[model samples]
Target: MVTMTVSHKRKDALKDVWDAVSSGWGSVTSGGVWSNAETEQEFEARLQRWENSGLAHEEAKRLGQKPPRAPRGWHKRQYPEIKRGDKAKYGVIGWARAVEVTRGANGWHVHIHAVLVLEGRQQAHERAYALGRSMHVRWNKGIAKRGFTSSKEHGLRVDVSEGAERQLAEYLAKAGEPEKAVRNSVEKAGKALAREATLGQHKIAKRGGRTPFQI
Candidate 1:
């Protein structure tokens, strides 16, 4: 059973992961990867699972016991923790951005706009393909028979460059806007852990592709 809670420590852990990804150190690139779902059915199903997991965890906590064991494949929606010991797989940082809306003609529409920073462009593409396949294989049925399709795979849409820093900062800012004190605490904790760059403060070259010190 995994007990997931929103705490200062957890927030800091997330900040550290975000800082590593935003730095783009060692040949990093960024892009949006769309999941391979011909219809939103598969994505919706996963969301239902996520919601149910949250409810179960809350219920268990209320009973003052260890949280119930999460269902298989439940980690897909949680924050991707970058363990210091796993340098190889931890090279990527990512998040899923999804929103649901009701359209007059289409009813409910769910769109997934996941973003990732990878070691390289080639790696970015390869990783996106793998992510799409994993999501399909994990939650969807008959993936072996129908196989995978580009339409259902993540689309390569953006190449994050120097300007990505600003975007990353914006993302972090928005993420913790609800609580300034907690956000500051997380930043401090993250910087202490990373010991490289402070959270949300690194000055990458600006929008013109030149650092402030550049002439």
Candidate 2:
């Protein structure tokens, strides 16, 4: 019974995607997601490139010369390792994910928030840990292919909770109503269950920086 607000125009389309992901699920054992962070050197190099591009464009305009075209298809050039991981045999029964991006002192950050439904209920913690480790390894390899690297410790996070499934169901059911009263209630409850399945992206940022929402 997950509920979310939608425009009158896009409600039907959103529902179709939701139905496909959440149709058949008995229980949720663990919840997890993946993210990669850049090194300081990588950040500086990218920033320098951006600044240089801006300067070059300005110079060309002043001289009445044709401005250089910015690099194109960079995202396309980077191999999408996550897509391959999604197709791997990971004992995943059903899953849903949203790709998110934000910028901070560390530069642009891209990550995935996902809810994975597993096949069975026995030894849930052990299973979740194993899965998390495996995911971390796979993620590292994938990011390397794209010329990025993340810490082994902070790359992937998986949490196991006995009451995760019920809390998740409640959170999803209340998260997307347009009414002011309903939205307030959902926020209160969502913060209480943020570590479980809530999709709000207000987590505190590392390195003494504020998250995009905070800024």
Candidate 3:
């Protein structure tokens, strides 16, 4: 676990870096609930039927390959390619990160945390809703009464504000399993900024100048 005592300066630096890296992107969280089966086996059977269907086999044949291994759940089967396509639609710019997807006898759920560079804040929600609808996943527009909010089917929850980067970053960092690219970008930027400040101080000291950071 990488822990740091966040001073005011450090916080400001992180905010700056996050903003710089994510300026044009709108933060989006989209997901769906597949089913509410009484047992896992019932859900698996449905998935198996879908996989063995002629349509699935035709899709594999169209790609000139065998059917891919079955995903453990809906999120695993669907979200990854959708995420990549979303990013690629913007010429492979911006970030697509996911938190852990979980399943239970009651239902299965996942949240895809994304920074949409191609779509501005003005268009993010519309685009997100369109995409969510196309995927046939339940998009929840408001909070659920209990349990995981993403498990509901209202609409896609999209937000793009001044503080959005930090909010999305924090979500991705939950459970110590952050999206690799965003986590590395934030960490690298912060480190580079600190190192530059330190080097600047060292240069001033070599010239017998007072260190500005000293109070």
Candidate 4:
């Protein structure tokens, strides 16, 4: 654990970060439940639970099949390629940084990670807020689409920062894990022979590509 020594000052800073994330997600949808970005008033009402384990156990359970894990911490990162994908011939936008796809009852929830470069730290924050409005800009008549909101009561979060070089490196390294979940599990099982006990069964072939007589 990082110990997360959060002072009131740190809390305020992180709140700004979270607001940026929520607003950006909302803007992508354009508006409504799909772009359900929480406002200042909403946070004022629910900050207690926000400081707590996200929501109560019931809500967290609803988000995950088993007990939900702690919410993933957000960070800003840099990628020379992601920032200049066009020149690299990869066909990606500079503003787009990361994305997360998750399974749920309805379907997969696709979360985007965008890191737009701004002038400075203050400008970075200002742009972060502005991005929130864009979350709903995609809605019909500038209305939001679905598959975004957490529920009626809460909204998702967006985090933005200036010069995310370190953050981007970490996200990229870990990104492979979730993307290859199924493939990884199958590979792991094939490599290990789990032990089982029965009354008579004892010595056996290594299963390490061994012939019966080799034992």
lDDT of 3 at 101: 25
Of the two candidates 1 and 3, the one with more favorable TM-score, higher being better, is: 1
Provide the clashing-pair count of each candidate structure: 2, 2, 5, 26
Q: In lDDT terms, how accurate is model 1?
A: 0.36
Between candidates 2 and 3, which one is better according to lDDT?
2
Candidate closest to the true structure, highest lDDT: 2
* TM-score to native of every candidate shown: 0.25, 0.40, 0.22, 0.26
| Clash pairs, model 1 backbone | 36-152, 36-153
Query: Comparing 1 and 2 by lDDT, which wins?
Result: 2
> What is each predicted model's overall lDDT from 0 to 1?
0.36, 0.46, 0.36, 0.34
Off by over 4 Å in 2: 1-90, 164-198, 201-215
Which regions of candidate 3 deviate over 4 angstroms?
1-92, 101-111, 119-122, 135-156, 162-215
Question: By TM-score, how accurate is candidate 1?
Answer: 0.25
> Tell me, what's the RMSD of every candidate?
22.4, 22.0, 20.9, 25.4
RMSD (CA, angstroms), candidate 2: 22.0
Q: In angstroms, how far off is 54's CA in candidate 1? A: 41
Instruction: Enumerate residue pairs that collide in model 2.
Output: 4-176, 5-176
Q: Tens digits of per-residue lDDT for model 3 on 1-215?
A: 00011111222343332332222122222322211123456556655675566456567868999866544444335421222333333232344342222222222222233333434554554664454443323222222111123322332444433334655566576776647755565555334333432344242322232333321
* Model 2: per-residue Cα lDDT over 1-215, one tens digit each: 11111111222243332232222111122222322344557667766676677667768878999987543433244321222132133445665555444445544444545556666667756766776666555555444443444564455666554544554456557767446654454455434334433443656666765555756
- Return the candidate ranking by lDDT, descending: 2, 3, 1, 4
